[model samples]
Every structure is written in structure tokens, then in C-alpha cells.
Target: MMLFAVEWQPPRLDTGDLARIAARLRGLRPLESILDDIGDVIGDQDPPAAEAPVLAERLRGDLVRLEDVAVAADDRDPRVAHLVARARALRRREAPTAAHPVTVAHLRRLVGAAEALLERLTETGTLRACA
Candidate 1:
């Protein structure tokens, strides 16, 4: 039996909100963080029976997906070697199902690498402003 002390519902995300959310993801922070914030907003509306576990799952998925992006970037652009390595490291850290000191450190590395790559692409005229 599902016994809930409080009724809950996630936030409503309009199409326009999603578009702006996507743009923020391209910023300095990791996408996992953005997912967490979104989840919190969802929880605020629906008040999840519990929030921590669900948020953790969302974050984990985001990291995994980011790792995939790193790998694909690796295959397409050998220049992204550092980012690729950091991504693989992050995947390994997250695969264990528990956080460690190294995990945080590695996450920072991945974010830095991703930011560097973004900067390089922008500087080289590969990615246009606001595009």
C-alpha cells in the first residue's frame, strides 16, 4: 500500500522553460547540477515522498550521459583527450554507487576540461555566440 503523508506533484515545465534550461546547461557548471536544480523545482511542486534518492538518480544519469558525450567527442576529435580521460574517470567513480573524495576531484576535472573545450571551439569560430 502506498501511504503518503502528503500529496505531491512535480513542477510544470513549459516548452520555453526547457529551451532556457538547455542554454544554461552549456555554461560552466556540469549538466548534472542543472538536473538537480530542476528536480528540486519539481519536488517543490509535487513534494516527492522523498527527494534525496530521486535527485541522486537524476544526477547519476546526467553524469553518465555526459561521459558518453565525452567519449563521442573523443572519437570525433582527438584534441579532446583530456576531457575524454576525465569523463572515463568520472564514469568509473560513479559506477561504484558511492561518492568518494576522488569523485569530487574528478568531477571538477571533467568540468574544467569541458569548459576548456567549449572555449576553444568558440575561439576557433567553430561555435558562434548564442548559437
Candidate 2:
């Protein structure tokens, strides 16, 4: 049953590089994109209630995107450290489970937090300087 063995490693973080890149005029495009996806599920144009399974799947996927940014951020930097802390706190709430189904309201909180983080990054970041 054994094929080949593979090793696992934690993600490597290089905040300086990330900041320099994100600070580009192009901006936080990836982060903004995930926000749009989350919006479709929670946006007013959509119905108040969504199917549980679909909502859960979307919720899990959005969290994974946030995790990517969190992993790549350096905690030594105060701004990114704060965002990372907020993301970890959200994780403590945990992802959706059958025993503890989450609602759109929960997703709203996540979206709000994410938007705030993005605002902070763009506002204080090098993106401002170049413009």
C-alpha cells in the first residue's frame, strides 16, 4: 500500500517581500478577489438564506484564503501581526461542522473583519506613497 513518502513543512514567511509586492500600485488584488467571492454569498442581491452545505463549503474556502495571507505574514511587523492575530481568533471560532452549523451572520463577521484588515493594509502601506 506504500507508494512514496513525502515530508511536510510549515509555510515560510517573508513579510518584507510581501509588503513590497502588495504595496505595488496594483494593490491587494488577491485579497480583494476573495472578498468578492464572499460577497456573492452574503450580498443583498442574494436571498437571505443559503443552502447549508453550500454556505459551509464557501466559508471553508474563504478561511483558507485568509490563512494563506496569515501564513506568509511576519508577526514581527506590527500591522501584519495584528491582522494575523485577528485571523487566528476567527479560527478559534472554528469552521462549520454538522454538529455546529454556522449561519450567514457568522460569515458577515468574517467579511467585516477581512475588509477592515484590507483597509488598514492599503491605507498605511507603501501603496499610498507611490500614488
Give lDDT tens digits, candidate 1, residues 24-44. 777545543543444453443
- Candidate 2 residue 68 C-alpha distance from true site, Å: 3.9
Q: Which portions of model 1 miss their true places by more than 4 Å?
A: 1-100
Residue by residue across 1-131, what tens digits does model 2's lDDT show?
Answer: 88764786767759987778777736534545666656766676542454544654555555555556545653244765676577557645754543322455565666665665555555655222212
Report the error of model 1 at residue 121, Å. 0.4
Q: How many pairs of residues in model 1 come into backbone collision?
A: 2
For model 1, name the residue pairs that clash: 8-46, 9-46
Which lDDT values do the candidates have, in the order given?
0.49, 0.56
Worst lDDT run of 10 residues, candidate 1, spans 95-104
